[model samples]
Target: MPRKVLVAYGTKNGSTAQIAQIVAEVLSKAGLTAEALPARSVTSVSSYDAVVVGSGLYAGRWHKDARRFVRRHRRSLAPRPIWLFSSGPLDASASERDIPPVPGVRRVMDNLEVTEHVTFGGCLEEGAEGRIARMIVRSGKGGDFRDFTAIEAWAAHIAEELAGPESR
Candidate 1:
């Protein structure tokens, strides 16, 4: 049996939403029931055994709706294991220590006590699309830097951690 998992997300240009869907599917395939829903639509977290919250970044900060979602439900989430993910950071090749998410983002996780936080590169748009990603990562900086294999791999780890050895 799989535990109910809520994968909530907030996206601006739809890239992060796509990433959330991929993560939900990956977790589902790992024997965990996962559903991706927009942050504004998810009214309650009481039903889920675990949660994975992700938000797209804009202007070097998390999306506002995503911040609100965590603030609204942080009390409920503290008792349960929670994982936080941010779909930003155009650079993906940095060493673990060099990740800005450490000191820069510690305060964000402190309120919710997220058991883990993951950062993946943001998605880019081509010339005709004219998405924000291209503007931010100009000068040949950004692209669709999401690592599908890495995403699935982490989801599997989360599933195993939550389900326990006996269940797996």
Candidate 2:
């Protein structure tokens, strides 16, 4: 049977969710069974063979739902292969270079011994919630900086790792 992977994300403006969906699609295409769901919606992680958790960074912190999900599922997640991602750079920095996870995420990585973590560019369209988000959009600092190519490549790598050498 194919490995079941869950790509759970906490997103405020929906861009992170989109990134998670793309990652799930790539994993599925690579022969794993993958599903993307909101972190808050997931009641358990015990059923998945592997898990990919992602969150939209805000003020140097991950979304609240992502943080809560990790704290809630830490036990069930520790035994599984795990990957993590963050999206919240409103600039080209992520695409141009590697962006380290914020302190909070780093702590979680250490605790979970995550397989990998990545930072992708973020998007804040006009209708985004929050006064700051609207201000940024109106000030012309908001736009999609996500690199789909990089996102897909990372997901493919995860699939390859999960598939193992024997499968190759």
Q: Please provide TM-scores, in order, for all candidate models, with all chains considered together.
A: 0.83, 0.96
Listed per model in order, the count of residue pairs whose N, CA or C atoms clash below 3 Å is 0, 0
Question: Best by TM-score, which number?
Answer: 2
Tens-digit lDDT string for candidate 2 (1-168): 338999999999999999999999999999899999999999999889899999999999999999999999999999888899999999999999999999999999999989889999999998999999999999999999999999999999999898885331
- Least accurate 10 contiguous residues by lDDT in model 2: 159-168
Model 1's number of clashes is: 0
> Per-residue alpha-carbon lDDT of model 1 for 14-75, expressed as tens digits?
88888788888988888878999999888899998888888877777787778788878878
Q: lDDT, candidate 2, residue 2? A: 36
